[model samples]
Target chain A: MYKIKVHVYLKENILDPQGKAVTNALHQLGFNEVQTVRVGKYFQLFTDNVDDIESRIKSMCQKLLVNEVIEDVDFTIENAA
Target chain B: MYKIKVHVYLKENILDPQGKAVTNALHQLGFNEVQTVRVGKYFQLFTDNVDDIESRIKSMCQKLLVNEVIEDVDFTIENAA
Candidate 1:
């Protein structure tokens, strides 16, 4: 099996209320060092092969993974035994 | 203020139990077409300026925004009036 990673975030000019909330919570918990905070998405995927990983996953991203106008994503691949 | 976006996801080959769970939930909700599913983080940030957006936000990602070892992420930027 293979593994795929996906991340999603909003554009720089966009505002993130959720991120701010989390940052506040984390700070309250004692991690006050988090001066600036933004929240995003994280995922790990398992697949059969890499032959079609990009085309398939990228398509999935556009359709179901991302909000193109206001978000960005970076993906990684690996062989999982 | 300027806005910043951040995303974080697990690297390919990594296993995401949470993603699987969400996929299952979505499937149960009726989106069965989702053959493969992974979940990640998404964030939007507001900043005072862009001059230091990259250095500051990128550093935030490494220190707090991302897991580095098992996740991938992409972010966008825009000017907010």
Candidate 2:
């Protein structure tokens, strides 16, 4: 089996309200050193070994895992223990 | 400055409905090789240099970034460009 870890985050230009709220909350909680926060999604996928796994994973991201318009995604594939 | 990346995921015993839904959707999309999916949260934090940054981050995670009851979190810190 192969393990795939995917990270999907908002585009640089996109405003992340959730992240902003977290930063503000942290500041109020006395973590004033925190300058900014960007929140995103992470996914771990387990799959059987297949030919062209990279393309398959990319297609999965493009089709359902990521929103291309407002977000960007990257992933790493590794052997599963 | 420092950049911290935090990953928060449901505990192993926890049921992840969203991830299950994604897995089902992928199967419907013909990716039957997919065995399982687990979804989680990712955070990018920018902070000023500070002593004991790792402990500070751990405190933040315990206090606000994560719910220790059902979630587990880990983070890595690095110098910011």
Deviation (Å) of B11 in candidate 2: 0.9
- Error at B35, model 2, angstroms: 0.6
Q: Put down candidate 2 lDDT per residue, B1-81, tens digits, no spaces.
A: 888989999998999999999999999998888999999999999987667888888999999999999999988888887
Error of 2 at B77 (Å): 1.7
The TM-score leader among the candidates is 2
Evaluated at residue B55, the lDDT of candidate 1 is 63
Give the residue spans of candidate 2 off by over 4 A.
Answer: none
Candidate 1 lDDT (Cα, 0 to 1): 0.67
TM-score of chain A of each: 0.85, 0.92
lDDT of 1 by residue, A1-81 (tens): 777767676776898888677788656654444455667776666666566567766776776668899988888877767
**Least accurate stretch of 10 residues (summed lDDT) in model 2 chain A?**
A45-54
User: All models: lDDT?
Assistant: 0.67, 0.92
Q: lDDT tens string, model 1, B1-81? A: 555556665675898787787677646654444446667776666555566556656666666667887777677776665
- What's the CA error at residue B72 for candidate 1, in Å? 16
